[model samples]
Target: MLEIKNIVKQYANHRALDDVSTRVEQGSIFGLLGPNGAGKTSLIRIINQITAPDSGEVFFDGQPLSPDHIGRIGYLPEERGLYKKMEIGEQMLYLAQLKGLSKQEATSRIKHWFEKMEMQSWWHKKVEDLSKGMQQKVQFVATVVHQPDLIILDEPFTGFDPVNVNIIKEEILSLNRNGATIIFSTHRMESVEELCDSIVLINKSKKILDGKVREIKKAYRTNTYRVEHLSHDVQLASVEGLFAIESREDKGENTALTIKIAAGRTINDVLAHLLPIVQIHELKEIIPSIHDIFVQQVTTKASNPLISEQE
Candidate 1:
């Protein structure tokens, strides 16, 4: 649904983005990931037309992005903005109208969202009277009331409690199911794992990784496995073909071990030898988490400046 091509942005001597490019598929939740000052906000601003890139282009639905496309996109910026004195319903209706909805249309949509989000009783309350989480819900409703084709959510669950978080998560899934494309940006890697179909990781003003979540995890695999067995003597020394033991801990009657396989051995081969020696309970591959991948990529880039230069 969206394509960012070779976008570059500079401010004085610093480059916020350097020829970064990525695609957002229709009806899919796409993750935009990076550490602080990684140019994530810069790219997001460019996409929203809050700022223009120094060079390159952004395309929406195969055409060059422009002001006319603004109404089709909903943006919830990381910095929350709401009129403190405005009533919940009034504020939402105003924002919806700004997105090009007629007053009657906005009221209808706002009413539906307020009811669906269980905020019907809070409609008359002022923004300042609500809790942080409650205010977040108000902003969320305001963002989607216009039924934008693309929704850009930055740190969407920032102040939400677990219950409300789950509520929003379900709504996001429902939105996707109903044909709204999502570009989710957050520091919470666990959320990415749960919701994103694909992701793009940027660091030091450049795109370092981009692919399907499962494919990226598979490509980053280290041939490590978490094995649980009844015996405690399943040490690295006792296990044949084990290159190294990453960690070991006791879990009730079973001892869990994370071991790296030797170069010439496979996980199945290692398991074959281990199964005979110990009563195996569980064995699973240790897939790297998005947090691990982020750290690994950013740290490696920082340590090797030449690598980023080459890219």
Candidate 2:
């Protein structure tokens, strides 16, 4: 739904983004990931037209993004903004109208969303009176009331309890199922793995990774395997091609061991020695988590700047 091409943004002597490009598919939840100072906020601001790129182009639905597209998009910035003394419903109405919804339309949409989000009793509450999590819910409803084609949420799940987090998560999924394209930006890797179908990783003002979540994890596999078998004497089992034992645990009569496959050998080679003395019950290859991939990639880039030069 959105295409950013060779985007570059800078401020004075510092560069925020450099020749970065990525695609957001229609009806897909795309995760925008990066560590601090990675230019993620700069790129997001460019997409929202809050700022213009020094040299780049953004296309929306195959058309060059223009003023007319503003109403068709919704943005919830990381920083929450609400008038402290204003009534919740009134503030929501004001924000909705700014997104091009009429008073009547805005009221209707607001009412529905408020009730759906279990904020019906909060309409008359003052922004200052509500807790942080309550205020987040109010802002969330205000963002989606206009039902924009593309929704951008940065650090959206911040300051919420787990129950409310799950509630908002379901709502986001429901929106996607109903044909809304979402660009989710957050430091939370678990949420990305659970909700994002694809993602783009940025660091040091450049795009470092982009692909399906499952595929990215598979590509980052460390050839580690977890094996479970009947406990036996350590000396009786021939350990071949075993680099290291990542972990070991005894469960009643069975023992579980996580071992990395040694270089120059595969899982089959590791099994060749253990199968003789131990009756194997379970064996599976270990895939790296999104958090692991994030740290590994960013750390590698920091240590060796030339690693991602191929991009």
Candidate 3:
């Protein structure tokens, strides 16, 4: 439930965001992606009302974004902030109240989250006494203790080992499952692929790509497939003009092949030609990862400044 329309932000000679627009569907995990200085942060700040766009508008739940909507939003910035001397539980209570929670309500939520995360023993620990990961958990609790309608996370997985990353990831999914709309911003494309239903790619202060994850991947699909089959007297070289073998590997009695369909040739045509010479075991199309598309989009825009405008 957020819509950003034709946002433009600038500072002196540098334009941070330029005519960028995107929509986040209610209860969906939307990814805000871009490389450094691509205006992702600028757009995020605008959404958080940390700064206003020089032009354009943002709507929260179909209405113009205003101070009243602040309580309904939770933001966890990339730079972690916590009172070093404050006890973990005390800090959480204060932050939650800032989001409009009553003291009693904040305490209840803080206790619930602390128990849920198995960090009940950390309530009395001071922020400076905790490790980076521990402090991160405390900050995360402070952010969501108020149960805001929209949660904005930037580089949220930083400073955690794989196990802790998975822990935080599960919590994010749980929030989404419970009907919280999330705006996830990170450099981790793998996370975006795993967590986001849709995404918008920004580059050089402009929107280069924006769509549902599945549709975006479908649009970038190449006619490539991986084939595995028994190698009983197989002669792949004999089957020419059907597909180009990109890679081939021998797995004992089986052969694995990565092939791209030849011009005017269908996938079934390649399968038809290969089925006779070998016992086909497995076949699947090779889908490009979000990381691949991210790099491609950024690099393409870098080379062609007008690419965003054209799209």
TM-scores of the candidates are 0.92, 0.91, 0.95
Q: Which residue pairs of candidate 3 clash?
A: none
What is the descending lDDT order? 3, 1, 2
**If the candidates were sorted by their TM-score against the true structure, best first, what order would they fall in?**
3, 1, 2
Candidate 1: residue 66 Cα off by (Å) = 0.9
The local lDDT score (0 to 100) that residue 49 gets in candidate 2 is: 92
Listed per model in order, the count of residue pairs whose N, CA or C atoms clash below 3 Å is 0, 0, 0
Judging by TM-score, tell me the better candidate of 2 and 3. Answer: 3
* Tens-digit lDDT track of model 1 for 60-163: 99999999999999888888799999988888888888999999999898889888999999989999999989989988988788888999999999899999
Model 2, range 86-117, lDDT digits (tens) per residue? 99989999999998889999999999998898
Over 4 Å off, model 1:
232-243, 302-311
Which candidate's lDDT is highest?
3
| Model 3 TM-score relative to the real fold | 0.95
Off by over 4 Å in 2: 233-247, 262-273, 302-311
